[model samples]
Target chain A: MPEPLFLLSPGRSFSSVVSTMIGEHPQCYGLPELKIFSADTIGASWEKESRPGSWPMQGLKRTVAELQFGEQTDKTVDAAEAWIRERFDWSGRQMMDWFQEQVGDRILLDKSPANTENGANLGRIVKAFPRANFLLLLRHPRPRGKSQYSTISKVLDKNGIGGMGFEPDVEWKWTGTNIMARQLGQDLALGQFMHIKGEDLLREMDLYLPQICQWLGIRDDAEAIEAMRHPERSPYATLGPVKAQHGNNGKFLKGPALDFERLATMPEASRDGPLDWDETAEFTPQTRRLAHAFGYR
Target chain B: MTLVETRPAPAALATLPGPDKPVALVRFGDALYVGTAAPDPMGRGRIWRMPWPAGGAAEIVYEGADGSAVTDFAVFESQGTPVLYAATAALGGGLLLASRDGRGFGPVAPAGLGQSGNLWLGPLAIAGGRLVVAAGSAAPLDPEASGARLLASPDPESAVWTALAEPGFGDAENSAIAALLATGAGLVAATANPLRGFQLWQMDPGGGWTRRLTDGAARFSMNPAATALSAGEGELLIGTGAPARPEAEDAAGPAAPEVIALDDGGAWETLVGEPRFSPEGFKVPFALQAAGFGQRETACVTAILTGPGGALTVVVTAVTGATPGPFGQPGLGASRLWRSLDGGESFAEVPAPGPVLAALATPEGGVLAVAGDAGAALHLHALA
Candidate 1:
């Protein structure tokens, strides 16, 4: 088994498509966002913060059921649940080893941006796979801010959870998530991490992707590059099997076609919006510093 | 629309314990019922009832177990008697209902309930003698067929709850009933699924529910989501906002916040929230704002109430800072009050602390509003 390549990003950072595209490389296997780094032990999922039946555990069960059993059926789900029960106390490194073995020969690719919420969470991934290459994903603060709000806006419309509709609130939340991720990745060994802007990946996939392939030490040949083009062809591309319905991005699950053209039209990030979220609320010093470092104005 | 006078509240309202936010407020008979999000620790939600107009200490009427927000609420007549209905977040928090004549409050379990873990029951309405409710749930994760449900109790007074339409509406995960309206023509409901945009469904006079307005084959474009449903003189008014949720935003639809009007089952026309949801239309924050990026959030129609003879319509919209505004970077962030003088037509901003959570039309034609964030700041306005 080869060392895995991990994607570190905030929610809504287009990590899903990129990671899956990388996994679609003939020499790699895209592991579902195992989120194994969230806890010290696998059973930690069921007992996180003393709240049993957490989403992580549920998500993991679904993932294992689909990936290991090769299908998410009644029997396969039972098998997955039994498997978890059998290895309840396994450490994070142990679980990663098991997945790597299962993904034998193919380099394992894991990207669960949610795990990076706590900076220490990435340390678990680092210790577990010392040779892992960490790819940092970024998006413009402005468009990312609008996107972050879109995620919560319908929530009030659906369940009546209050206080999430504020535009500044939404933007700040986006800023914090991205900022934390960027700050956390700064300390990694230069060779172990690389930064990739979402817009660049989208508008110039042909340009950036080959460089990423070269960096991964994988074949940059036409055939290997062609394989990454059809992420939809991956077994787990379109929604995962029944039990493990998601191992990637929710939006990409709709079709999985990588259309760089659609992302090309995104207007340049602007403090001014038709929605008129406080224009004064432009990129703060912290976000501005990071955006500037990433080559944004 | 213009800003009107701001007056002190006729009386102070009790606050929910801790951060148990006030999620729903509705008028029931001679009393206004306030529903609060469940308190911490126990996660027990509460309902307080206060006598109308003449202010006094509110009485705690119901305490719900689970972290149920008591999100959807309605008090309507059942066989000429008042019946109360409430819904909560997520599956297993069963639909709650109580008849004024029945023994007491209890869970109303619809048949085949508890089928999905994602269904958090919300959106309630009374139309055509039927008590209607919409369940918020994601579509089945698999490609297998299923969706969020639109349910109707032909007699909410009875134990009968059935689907208004077939099982599937849109992609179950993204699809939800955003608003409901009971009109003389039919019981209308609006649905949003990022994939299909937004659609209008009507339970007709013949007891059959059918699709009314939709994008047809163009499932690729922006479908304005409808919320803030209200009654207008001889017409129905619907408020809209941009599709909420980053996952849904992949459609890149426009956030067009415009209030739409329907007259005698006629064409649905842009009423007050036009071109841009410029303050008066009681627009729900935003619908589809293509160019303006920063303002996609921050404001939403929190509540809609009516004055006597249904001549005056008031919408309470709130805007609060999550974090950015704290640094003195202010956008269109403020809880505001908007009014419609000619029954959901022209509008104006009124004097009041914004992000007005709820409002009730006083019998004297003034408006009693529950504004401010988390059930603070109560105020009353005399319509001039």
Candidate 2:
């Protein structure tokens, strides 16, 4: 069985696209945000929660149906749900190992950002896949943090749900991102963790795409690199079956055609936080230091 | 457990306006005060006070801020006056204390739920001769202050609230204090959101809290929020929801309806196993999976009543949905009534009510079941 490749981050990073792009490799299989590793046991994963607007298991059911049953129908999705219910008491390790074994030699590219939020989550992954490799995907805290702030508040407001105020949201963005930094940087061996920036891959895909392939030691052939660049061609780039309609990121699912124009709108990284969310706020000195450590200016 | 036959569909007692959402129910003096969110979201709330067994002419006792919603209730009788604490859901509503005063309610607790972290304000009880209430952060994303804290107040007069249980104690499995019961063992609390297993926390003599992990969770336990807890024949009967997980469902298959009984002698027994229902004249499993049939989340015991002659009645409501997961619409949230003949050794379903969100024992030797949402009603039934 091929070891899984996990994209670890606090999201709003280009994990979906990057993970999908890597999965586009002929020898690899890209997975949606199954988030199968967030909980210690398979039963625990059902109780796991994330910040608002997090993707649910509709994607996982869809992925399982498409990959295992060879087709997407109401029956297959129902069977997939039943299949999941059947393993209610399995440990997270047992479930992940089963998935890896089922995939056989295909490298499973999983871009589950929540796995990097807590040290306990990372600890579980390390214990589950001793030979697993991690891609520490970083998005500039300034724009990425702002995006998260607006997105979280917008969803809460739209749904009539209550949450922390603007200032706390900014602090949360900083704190969550910092936890990601510490968890991956501190827990893993030097060689096991590879850091990458979303900006580099978006603006300079031709160069960085091949470079990433080389680092992972997958086929560096022209066809393989070209296929890797077209993440939109992946089977999960659009809405899935009726029962499991979402198998990928909402952004990527809508218009997966990769373009660099969105990167132009992002402001330069800043020491000060999104002041609109918090006027009297600045990143903690420790958070700032960690940001710099991630090669952010 | 024997099959208790059907009586009749629970009939409505009174009619209220549409979109009236109930928050909390409390019995103060001879009146049962019901907290309801006004029809208009921005309108002031109305507290309806109904006379016990008489059950006629429910008059409005007090009206609160426009668009305010009540979440929980607490009874505090410290400063010589028995006061009912009504916790408003959102911050703007604040907390209201209802007494037999001129207006019936006044401010008692502050309103700052999402200000610092997730504010937990329930599982109230009288433990260690003090009024105990739970307050903590429930936000899973907020690493700091993201668990439960049991606050103890010596009397209603004292403003100081000391920590009875350490913060983060209920956060072991994203579990927080969900239900509280005053029992012979001690003031007990049940936590929610199961992983390793569910547990019950008990108040000790030293003014501290201890917990007992519930049995039957092999790798992970059900997020059993003890919605209904009753003590009878020196045993505690618990009704809870298993909360079906699409990813990590129980290996025994999806959890069926269940109730657990804890004996006064420190022995815990599973009163109800993987629960099954027989809605007279229909095969429950086939009926539930049929096209028009509705499937709900794991069974949630809503209310348990201890009647005369060592009999116990447990009411369960399964919030059925058109689809699964968090986003599905609850098409048919059904609540059923069950009774145990010999203590709580077993139970039988009595076809009586719809999704009964709440049930209260009436002074007339019967149980008053409040059922449905949107089209809501109050029903009266005799148990045992």
Candidate 3:
């Protein structure tokens, strides 16, 4: 059997795009984050539920909306959510079993970022599927923080959830989450695990895309290369209901180029900016010194 | 002289029934209870309890209905009645629950516990009729400066808890209070700090606490924190360390947290080091509990070892690993039974039928080992 590829990253680390690219390879099939492993227990109900509001389910919904609905409007997204609620009835394990069935003898790609938060659960996954490989996507602390705040805020706004009174400090959460994931991966000696930077993925997709495919034992052919070039073709591209206008002049469904300059100047609570690259980056001195010493850095 | 015949594999013991999210097990009377995390369907958490000797089936016992997870549990008997206490954290508050029936539990809200940051209550023990509870900060990612606090329940039946003393143990952040024992001297608490290492704290009845022994970076890795505490024959025994940390070229290998034997007034000494037969790199110790023997000085060690395959292997370690073999091999079967004739210096395999999940020495020298996944059966092994 082909080994499953697990993508480990914090929320909003370009996992959707990269995972889709890797899955597009002929030998691979990218999966929506089933998130089955995080449940305290492995059971039928946990797999069937569509946790729409959660980060894991949102990623899954986006993928379904883009693939099944093909529309980015609020009305279309809502319809897609209803569609999912009505149609899918499987637990995370069942979903994985289905994936295995669909891509018989082919490598499976799991793209859930939340799984990084759980060590015991992750350990269970590796134990259950010994051949699984992990691809850890890293992002610059400041920009990543900015992206997370924007994304979380947008989600809250769209769902009509009121904004938290406190300005979101993305740097703190991002750095903390990354540090945890890094420590867990190291502690487990996950031999199949590899780390990739989000900046590198976005700036040099052409070069790195094929490398990822090759690492997962997938053939990087022309069709796959073209598919990688057009990530909008990913099923998750336009998956959710578009949020109501909140003065922000950007489409929530579209993946926009990260504006590093604008992000750097954002308030500490906003983007957690001026993220002294050497300090905020995972395994950097700032994170290592300030955070609990996991001996990873 | 003729050699003694080896006993057959012991029959499977009763299994505990409930959600399989790793559990905290406590035995009171003929009943055993496993405390587990039952987060609300909406994502909050509550404590779920199920009868031990029953497979993993569960019924809600205490609802943090407010959004906290019931992280730890302790059970003790007051005047022949079983009283249960649980530590819970949710919605920015920490609380302890006390129960008379062990089923209908009520909150033991103390006047001023620490703020509702990540904290958990662990190991409930009764000595001299006082209910002693240990509280500590949750894990590394949660927060720091969270030391372990002791709450004394004057009346285990009353839902009132008073802070008796603080262990003053250095930041227990990212570690759990493995086990607590009431020694003739005072109280000894085993704590594992995943990053800083593991240490044993000695607390005097008068309210002074000091570090007894500090091992060099041996407890860090992924070893489970201490879980069981018991006293026998003037020696204190502690079961700790979870599955070993898997070996990596860049990562540290597993550190064998042990079931230690501490002298009457002296510090702790290692009785069982990390088991040599454990899966190559998995460091976490699976399960441990103390068993009582009639003579007080003779106690048995019942422990579960988790291997790379996620299989639970049970073994009985005596003073040394020299215990007679039972099943095909030691430490490889689902569970094996052993006896320690000379304290815990060596171990010999007993005729346990199948893999056992937990074992507690009985007052009669016969051992009671809990087996099956999640508490399925209770196996009784009688020793002559």
Candidate 4:
């Protein structure tokens, strides 16, 4: 079986849209934010998701339904939940194998932001699939932090918990995740992993996507590339059944299409300014150094 | 001229050690040779060779002692065989090494031409049936009469180096010769004078020398050194800036690099830089569409290579000081590659692999660049 390609990045780095587009490629099967790697087994993962405020298990349940029943609905989602409970002892690796088997020879792509939150999560990935391909997607920390705060603030506002001294600290998440992904590169073969800035990819997808396909030794012909343009065509692109309404970002699920105009005119914030959440606190020097290393000023 | 906003990715031939700075690249025999300056003891200023037309892992051909660097590489005909000449930059003195084959090398000239001050030799040119070279001081800009020395040798194997011009071209402030080119006019040498600006001097075939552009070609001393020189269709293309390894006082000085053209009739035209009126007549930048080449930062035009079909590739870098950023240090300023197909009328930016230190035209109609961050890894990449 071919090794899966894991799109790894910090939260709010365009991983959802980019991964969905790449998964739309004829040779790959893009998975939602399974968040299954946080624990050793499917049961453990389910238990972890049961905790409040944890990343919901909607993505995992929806993926099980879509891949097993070839369609996602209320009945299929319930069946998917029961299916997971029946296989409590199944390891995450076993779960990935079953999904890969269902997808045939297509390369499985998983981009779980939570996987990078824990070193053991990434280690589990490499140990389970030693030959897996890793794509470390990066975003300029300034925009990443801003977008992350925007998403969190909107949620807090909707929940009537706005401005309750809940400051979102995005610096650690952005830097820590990318640093872990870079360390992951050291464990892989030379050509088995790559690091690409999300901004560059979105700006010149026509120029870089084919290069990426070539890197994966996949078909880069026009038809195959054209298919990748409409990431919304993916079955998981929309909101799932009410039980599993979100396996991805809510905004992305609402309108999961490439916004060329917005991407082209995306506001660029320099890495050297004070934090948006706190006016007095600036980005740590180490964070700025790492950002500079990634070719961001 | 056609411009591709998105440049195609080029193949990486090799990656030198983190402490190595790739300074020179030349095509010899069936392979491309790369020379690196390693300040650390482990690197030893190594030279590497990769198979041409079929690039793979590059093997180290020669390695120098600690604190030495391969400054430049030149190919010249010795009898019927083409000999490779490698210049060394060292503390005590520089050595000119020669080899009939690319692997093994022997000294062709005495270290520093027997002058301890001439610790660096480079910018070799073959003109008037003789091998001409310039020797100067490296970093920490030496002030011990180790200033620029222009030398020529009719019989290089004999190792007899004759001074073509006085030390520092008779100016103590002219610490080094940053660039040399054999043009239709003669052997042209550009000096690195941080004090009085860069000066261009040409030695004619009749053993006569003439100062072509003085006071940085009317741009004043701001243009301190001529960093690169290349032959145009019917003229000489000169790239001016502060030296890569600059003097302490000149490191933080204002520098807006420029590319000037010199015709055979001794006329001058500024290709890129501030448009001004000067002794060179009313000067206007031909590529006014690309003033400063779209770079607002203080930068220097480092290397220029004119290839087949009138394609010209120029490497520009913002002077980030002598010590390039290593793994832990702040990274060096990014380098940009601009190419022109209609002479200097318009230029298109080509994405570079890293901070390009030097560039050379390949035999296969491509541009090979020696790019690296100082004290960081060096990479040899081809620009298509």
TM-score of chain A of each: 0.86, 0.87, 0.65, 0.94
Tens-place lDDT per residue, model 2, B104-207, is: 67655445322343243554677667776655443111112235555667763445666767664635554555567787678887665443334666777665
Which window of ten consecutive residues has the lowest lDDT sum in model 3 chain A? A244-253
For each of the candidates, give the backbone clash count. Answer: 42, 6, 66, 1
lDDT tens string, model 1, B124-163? 7887667777765421111121245777776664666777
RMSD of every candidate to native, in Å, equals 22.3, 19.8, 19.6, 17.3
- Among all candidates shown, the one with the greatest TM-score: 4
Please provide, for model 3 over B134-206, each residue's C-alpha lDDT reduced to its tens digit, 9 standing for 90 to 100.
Answer: 6655421121325456667667556566665544354534355556677787777766554554566776656
**Tens digits of per-residue lDDT for model 4 on B233-338?**
8888998765333431222223557888888888988777654334344355787632246454556786887865666777787765544311011124788778
lDDT of 4 at A202: 81
For the predicted complex of model 3, DockQ is: 0.02
Specify the highest-lDDT model's number: 4
Complex DockQ, candidate 4: 0.01
lDDT of 4 at A294: 51
Q: Return the TM-score for candidate 4, rounded to 2 decimals.
A: 0.52
**Residues A126-160, model 2: lDDT tens digits:** 88887787777777777777777787778778877
- Model 2 DockQ reads 0.01
Instruction: Write down the C-alpha DockQ for each prediction.
Output: 0.01, 0.01, 0.02, 0.01
Note the Cα lDDT for every prediction shown. 0.57, 0.58, 0.49, 0.73
